[model samples]
Target: MANDKTSMQLVANGILKENPIFRLALSMCPAVGISTTVMNGFMLGIAVLFVQVCSSVTISMVKNLIHPRIRIPTYTLTIATWVTVIDMVLAAYLPEAYAKMGIFVKLIVAFAIITMRLEMFACKEPVGASFWDGLGMGLGFMIGMMTIGLVRELLGSGAILGYDVLGFKPLLFFILPCAGFFVVGLMMAFFNYIEVFYKRKKGFTS
Candidate 1:
């Protein structure tokens, strides 16, 4: 039972405390570039989740065999291999979504968050722990992207998932690259505020 609790905490840490976008502020490039629409962000999130999990597991399994001197390149290659496979699969099977996502899917190979996990957590942790960490981080990234996308889509185009909600766009700037920074900054502030409030409440109760 204690083990189960620890595992759940590991997952929650990524989703809430160390969220890739809102908390750690990693991988801002994709977060800003592909978040113009809900679909775009969601699709990119799915791709990242798959690659992060696979790469983390693979790295953990082989950590013992890797030489310390060249591990970074090896990790990069492993991540790139997964990214390539995913990119090809998407292009072949889901051509429409792939077309929309384009190079962003391939770009996951270069994301700092995924590589950081490979070096910081997966390399040092047991396979099971690494898997949970990867799962948590991946889900966090997905949720963050989805939130940004949802907000941008709703306010910028007055739509959700491409369906018109308000009959007209209330803020055209929300869909632009410049507005991504503003939206992300606002969301980061919101999450930080919630975190502060939670900590204060916990402290008072204790």
Candidate 2:
């Protein structure tokens, strides 16, 4: 473990300061594509969480054995292995949601958030720290996905988790691809404001 950070700090960093979506702007393609419904976001987020945690720990455990020249491919293979496992699990147990998610789950191997962490943190951190880091990032990604999904679904469909609660759609455009970017952009601004407020509250900035 790194002496500079405790496990809690590692987790908090991923969840807040370095959120994969809102803060880091990582994995925007997937975020805007499949976040049309709450279920889709939750399911894909779970898949990513599993893959990220597994790959992070695996890479950390074998980091010393990997060659510097081939580490990129090595990381891809490690991530692919975990992605395959979760992909199959989702297909087998959650066929309906899997159908909805389609290729997004499989494409998690290409997610910049996962690959970046593997290269930047997992490859250098101890296994325990890597695990915490992965857990934190996985959770942050999941939360971001779910939040986007909830907003899009509620506004687009006037429903929550496919159940009609509002009785009428307010912003039908929100269901479209263009709205995905708009919603994300709005969310990014909201989070930015919150961060600024928090820093001011803590006297960390003027």
Candidate 3:
């Protein structure tokens, strides 16, 4: 029971408590930049997911051999390698998404969330724990992106995934880059509300 609980916590942490976007606010660039639409958000989210999981697993396997002093550079390089792979793949096969994403996909290398995990979680944990952490964080980030995108797309375009639901666009402002922050802020508030409610229900007061 204890092992299962630990593993569940590892996976759940990123999805809620330490959510990279809504909670931790780690990588806002892609969250606001490409999340103008669900398709754009999903594409970038997939790219981030691949990089996070792969880098975490790789770092976990090789952390001991890496010199502590050079670990930052090493993590950057490792993330860059995966970023390059995804970049090439996206450009070749998913050209439309690749174009829409443009430099944002490449920018994944410097995303604080990825490098932070490498240094903080992957470097110290066993491979299994690191894998769960990576998966959780990646999924959390992906969901955040999609949620933002879905709202923006619906509000901005009067559509969801290009299917028109509303006869008219609800709000043109939501499609704007600035709107990303506003939407994120609102979502963050809601997220915090739920977190607090859960904590209180669990009998915690802080």
Candidate 4:
């Protein structure tokens, strides 16, 4: 049915076309805050992905139960529950990365991307479609964060995922907070450039 196709398209668009960080430009705080290394970025990505998917599902399921006047509080409760679980699980098994990520882990509860998707898309869609949308959006965020971490590690630290690519001194400044903004900006611009060229070659409008 056309409706099903539209749902699928919405899901796909969330993941690739309207990525929370790269495309929609949401949740850059966590993206840049926790991506100091590959492991850190990977953990942060997984945590955020989990939080986003779980919160969306929960909110979707309870969408009709909450009154419109208090929907925001209900959504916050749903998000908080999942984020707490993620935090506890990571702290128990992955203490090192947990320590490295620090307060950023706790901050996931307030990530506007997850909340936005839950309210705007998930609450209005079927469970399956909401799930896919969450998956796509989460993966998009993961990809963007990992890309930033990869660049920062390679350029600022001369490694990818902590493995030495070249025996050269790194630019320590790139590992700093300011460099996160700089690297993310350049990387986004690069992605845009590539997308533009691809669209031109295909003669398709994005």
lDDT of the candidates, in the order given: 0.90, 0.91, 0.89, 0.83
- Which lDDT tens digits does candidate 3 get at residues 78-174? 9999999999999999998899888999899999999998888899888888888998999899988999999899988899988889979889999
lDDT of 1 by residue, 108-128 (tens): 889999999999988888888
lDDT of candidate 2 vs native? Answer: 0.91
Alpha-carbon runs more than 4 Å astray in model 4: 1-3, 6-11, 199-206
Ranking by TM-score: 2, 1, 3, 4
Candidate 3 vs candidate 4: the TM-score winner is 3
Which candidate do you rate higher for TM-score, 2 or 3? 2
What residue pairs are clashing in model 1?
Answer: none
Per-residue accuracy of model 2 over 1-206 as CA lDDT, tens digit each: 46479899999999888999988899987799999988888888888888989999999999899999999999999999999999889899989989988788889989999999999999999999999999899989988998999999999989999899999999999999778989999988997798799999999965
RMSD of each: 2.8, 1.9, 2.6, 2.4
The better-scoring model by TM-score among 1 and 3 is 1
For model 3, the local distance difference test gives: 0.89
TM values, all candidates: 0.91, 0.92, 0.90, 0.90
The number of the candidate with the highest TM-score is 2
